[model samples]
Target: MTFRAKQSVRRFILGTAALACACAGTLSAAAAPANLAYDKPAPTINPKLTALSKAMQPKVYKVSNRVYVAVGYGDANSTMVIGDDGLIIIDTTESLTSGRAVEAEFRKISKLPVKGIIYTHHHMDHLGGAAAFVQPQDAMSGKVTVISQADTMKLLASSETAKANPLFTRDIMTARFAYMFGAYLPKGPEGVVNNGTGPAMVAGPVGLVPPNKLVDDTLDVTIAGVRLHIVRTPGETDDAISVWMPDLKMLATGDLLMGETFPNLYTLRGAEIRNPITWYRSIDRVRAFPAEYLVLSHGRPALGRDKVASVLTNHRDAIQYVHDQAVRLMNKGYGPDELAAAISQLPPHLRDDPYLAQFYGSVSSSVRQLYASYFGWFEGDPTTLNLLPPKDRAQRNLALMGGEAHVVAEAQKALAARDYRWVADMLTDVIRVNPSNMNARKLKAQALRQLGYAEVNANARNWYLTSAQELEGAPLQIQNDWFRGVASPQARVAQFNAMPGRAIIGLFAPRLQAERTLDVHKTLAFVLSDSGDQAGIEIRRGIAEVYTQAPPSPDFTVSTTKAALARLAAGDTTLAHLIESNAATVQGDRQGAETFMSYFDPPLKDWSDLHFTTR
Candidate 1:
């Protein structure tokens, strides 16, 4: 091995050991002052605004004589419509515990049997708690019909499955979730004030029941004697749908149009860029309806004919305004960040309009997403195509900036001037170079805390504060063992099962030792005996090609159950153990098969636990 490679490995090992030690007792070792002045919320925050934000609480709103919505039960809302024969529910809170709370409260208003459930989209918060409303057995037996877009299962499963690239890890995703949801925030005014979606999330296992019926397009149907027109609204997700109750003149728009806040065309937690044109088209359809009342998934119901129309129009106008202006600038050759900065705020007339508040989605993320949707990520800059990786860039930048001390000193000056954003950017490189710098860590925490406190957007605040807690060396339990602690084994296995088999095999290429395998040519045939699905793989010079079946000549064939194979692939078990347990059998050459497994490395990648994650 070269000198630099060996030194890198040693540095990695040492850094990991230091992180473990920090996670164990750093908080006490680097305790903050008994009353850290900067720990308080920013002095500029409006008192009235904070109180109004805290007023978000769980309650049932009667939208009409027949329709009611359970608001703020968790980070989502559930709407129930009572019919002559039974009841129909639209959306459910985030988890089973939260769903049960809303269900109990809903029973206070009506005791009618649940006849059907309508999921607006493929988001977990919108439908993860379906089981709390109705038993799975009932849905499976056709007692209660569950309906969603036909692509719901495929889209939902794709989201939950493992990433094909190691650069995108679940820990990073979970870490982003922690930031977006304020998982690390304390339960009080000082932290976790409100998630724009609702009051807060409830702790419990997520309950999911797959849809039994599918809605492919515009369908006019009746459930439990309630006349409804379901429109496929492709905005937040491809499987998004909206229900319009013609009889009652009520339109139930799920997260399609959120509460007194700007719609999130792009989420910081990472998601596909929402198509602005499609979203505007969907809003226009809702505007065409003469709805007297509207049920939302996060905020209070919009009542009265004129009031609902005005609200819907304002939202539509804002969406179109951003899209139109953004596209015009892109035509003039403005890149994403430039366009984002230019369109920092809405027009004055619409800025303070109740529906256009920057509570959930900010203009920065929106402009970027819209620009990408229209022009794609390439900015016509050739240098960016061959950009340096993060670590290398950080090292070079820090070296040019006269090392960590110079940057930290400048950050201290920025902190003194109350410029939190500058402080964050200034200290980022220093921390990346050496995360063990206690001084830099604490300063960065203070900057993030102040920024989070002063921010108006819920997601931005949650991320800033959560990141602050991390720099202060706060340890998260789930951050340690994500799969075992965050979700059940069955759920994890189901995600793996839903992933395309080709994607599963493609993940192996990055782990192959091309240097060792440059001269070694080998072929392994994988056959799922139970499912009768087979894939033949040939690896040469670290390149892998997969076929529908085993080649005419293969060195060995490994026939096994998908379950055993998934377990081994997940690093949960070993191939030798599977062979010994009779779950797998190797024919032709057992030694060659075992050697093949060794040729390709298992995933052993991890990033720094500090706040600056790649996600």
Candidate 2:
């Protein structure tokens, strides 16, 4: 090896060791304090949210003689169905680390080849660890069939990067996702106690293998002497599916019945509005199955026919109740906030039902989402159509309320009275008028912390506390560490190497710097020598357009294997090094290729600037 190559290997080894140490103690370390004043003992937590933690304790549940589930190892659960000659793996959790841990426990049960891997949906938590359960060549060659709904690939493509229209980019979605899952916050009473749906969002390599077998409505097949039926349920996600085993009398519900929490009709992280009507109808379909055991992608499995029926019934009823009531209030000329207020809690039976707890999805957020689904953002108010900008509105509101000082004083009084919600709202105006005003910011943070402590919903609690931390100028920039912890550098390189050449090229468009590219027009062609796949990017004034066809006359062309591309994308090796090593060869001007690359924005390594609050 060359001197530089040896040096590179040494640096990678050292970097990997350092990353291992950071991830090893991540769960136990406290988030650094941005302001010492805000750092105190664990705040008072709602007893219900605290109690939910017990259900997430790591354990392997033996549902029956034929089935076993591993929960609390990650954000979602994985189930193994024993067959005559092989096993059927369902929903492989969220990360490679979690999947491997579950696989170890399953090995203790019975070692069998995974004949089929079923993805309940396209959500990362359900299918991210696919590589752990089955080999890529096996899946590609149909030795092990990977299955999912027909729409799964389409949805997955959208989330692969920013959309063409760019209404909600992947960056924004990821930022909100980090907050919703409490990715950066410390794990404790004052911070993230539990992920309502599971123990926590485990950070490690996400190995997503696209499905080879597609299911449209329902498919009945026998694998390894085990009869199975895969049905499209379409509840939490558009492509959601469920598996049923007639012989075992077991039904594995994906997110259709998300454990004990009320269905997440609308997630705070944001997505296409989950129509409550469609959701409940989907639940009704799953309820039709005569199953003795109910296994879930999240939470514990229900044993016995009666218990299974009861959980399904309550879950569907909860969705229908929220949907119908929100529509009823909407017809009465109530807006989103009013609809939420009118039906903040479910009826006595549902509210009290252990299965219908708002530990994951709250009624208020669902109501607001339901309203938005039926009626767009207008809310039937003409004045709201041309409302003042946020800054202007805040400035005017502060003037009407005497000024920043007066509003802060009033918020202080409200805080003293323990009216946290009002204090948060009033202080928001003052802080908006003067984002640098530390007093208003501090007061708002205090109120938010109190409100977070009282929330029964884990998602809301995490959001509240995360926002409060941001408001206190906490060095939330450290959140990038959690992102890095998701996968080792080598693991990430492998993941990118496994991606399709076209998809890899697609990821570059969203990062195009429009201003920088306004006067620059260039074409860069990528030819994967190993796979014979050709893709190209055209810099058209300000937009980077990606296509899979070979360009007629490209300004620059790079001939390399996908693995070489992966090393460059994962920052494991430089393009210059790859070229020097003959891993990649350039046709046409190499300097032009470098200049073309500079037109795109660099990857964001630190996300502290993407603040949830105090913007």
Candidate 3:
């Protein structure tokens, strides 16, 4: 089998022997028969995971004289293209701190002014740290060109912007993201070794500067004497784009071909169903580029044409194989779970390639997602349409299994017999019936820990272990650091203040206290003195209807800057204080304006209680 990395760089790759060693150390001990067990080794986390994670160690990979990629400086790789008299930055890392770190390294490479900034997609990992690279004023004035797909901002409105703040689902998505990335787990063997795509998410001030130049299909442009081809390839994201430097023969692929691991056909963290067909076709387009070097946003770069071609082919073929095989089984009357069971592994050729490793994406999960995408959640089973609630079902199951005590006893025996899956399944009922039951929680945590220790997929391992920690109420350093540092109330207030005035007012609709406003009929118009953006809200019946246009006859009008509004929402100040201090002015009834402000819920005091496995 051809390794993805060259022999000299092979140490960067995780060997099959490491995985075998990990299984031999822990899983083998768990499976040993009681009668045959003379001496069992102590349980330990997977060493393969630890070895695989080292690929994210901070280092500047020199692709060529003109291009350099800083990997592991942050969760996402940042590339600096050294052009004559200037520079172009492609995909800033996840946070300002990380971007600064990468910028410092690039300063060592060249001190030329940044002529342009390119975002491959709208993901925070790619664009959030943009502020660290170029000044906002320079980008706005076109002194530095900001290029991206035309649909990037439109897509951002739904997820990354304040428009998403109106939807309660964003909160759940944030919590899931934290869990999927193991954001709260320590960077060690027992916790998170590394993020599947990169190191780990860097939590800090996330900034965004809207693109000035948008790519429709393909654009041929010259920046600082470097001619480049930017092609729109809808793969991992609908707005995904790939950059090809014709002169240098270097292709910079964003998350399209994510790291050395198999492409995440469907991430565990919630996202729109990524079409596998589109993803493979997109790879085919990039395959046409006769690139000598492949610089990726997640993993190490490939140095030769043959090496790059081989890796690209195997990666796309793996995605197509998973898609076709799953659909084939689905046509044969296989359900979601059945399809996952049927297509357990790839073909030997593709399976043997190191690029197709399941370190990030799992065959089972992708297969299940395929089923969901095509057929919805229903599997032609009527019973699933109106099934009993989980709590009620658990209560009934406990009743049938004698009692909670008997169920716990059976789960204990299953754990002893090395049947961790069954133990977890059985204990879910006990936990549901009695959340405070320490015996059930502890046993479930133990089962999950063992399962996590033996799992090679980093995402699944992190999820399992994090869930266990939640059940046991264990403290994590990342959680504390997040709340105290970048994610603090003051920090969030500043973030909100920096958002568009329209977005700040849009959040009002979702935070309205519907019960209190049901009988109240009032209208309030907001005019941002700083940005000159105006929006209005009318409380009628049970809804707070928001409009960009001015209201016909607002009971009162509050004129203030977006910053003051953010502070008011965060409970840092009050409407009365704003009026008294001349920070805001009321054009109409002052009493009505205060009443209008009182109708919305205040910002959350603490987000630490948002757990993945808990209610």
TM-score: which candidate is best?
1
Model 1 lDDT tens row, 105-125: 778888999999998887667
lDDT of 3 at 38: 10
**What Cα-based lDDT does every candidate model obtain?**
0.71, 0.77, 0.75
Q: Model 3, range 1-615, lDDT digits (tens) per residue?
A: 112112211211112112212221121212211111011222455655555565666778899999999887666889999999899999997656567778878898899999989999977688867777898679879999899987776554432333234234444555565677676776565676666677665555545555778898999999988888999988888889999999999998898888877777878877655899999999999999999999998878888999999988988999999999899989988998898888878899988776677778888889999999999889998998999998899899999999899999999999999999999988888888898998899999999989998886788987898889988877643542322343345544554554456656666777788898779998899898876778888899769888776778888899998779878865678899999999999999898899888888876554446765655
Report how far off residue 194 is in candidate 3 (Å).
0.8
TM-score of 2: 0.81
- Candidate 3 residue runs with Cα over 4 Å from true position: 1-43, 84-86, 103-116, 128-146, 151-168, 202-212, 475-486, 498-502, 511-524, 553-559, 568-603
Estimated TM-score per prediction?
0.83, 0.81, 0.82
Give the RMSD in angstroms, all C-alphas superposed, for model 2. 7.0
Ranking by lDDT: 2, 3, 1
lDDT comparing candidate 2 with the true structure: 0.77
Give the number of the best model, judged by lDDT: 2
lDDT tens digits by residue: candidate 2, 295-375: 999888999999999888888888888888888778889998988788999999888888778988989998888777777
Q: How accurate locally is residue 234 in candidate 1, as Cα lDDT from 0 to 100?
A: 79
Q: How does model 3 score by TM-score?
A: 0.82
Clashing pairs in 2: 204-486
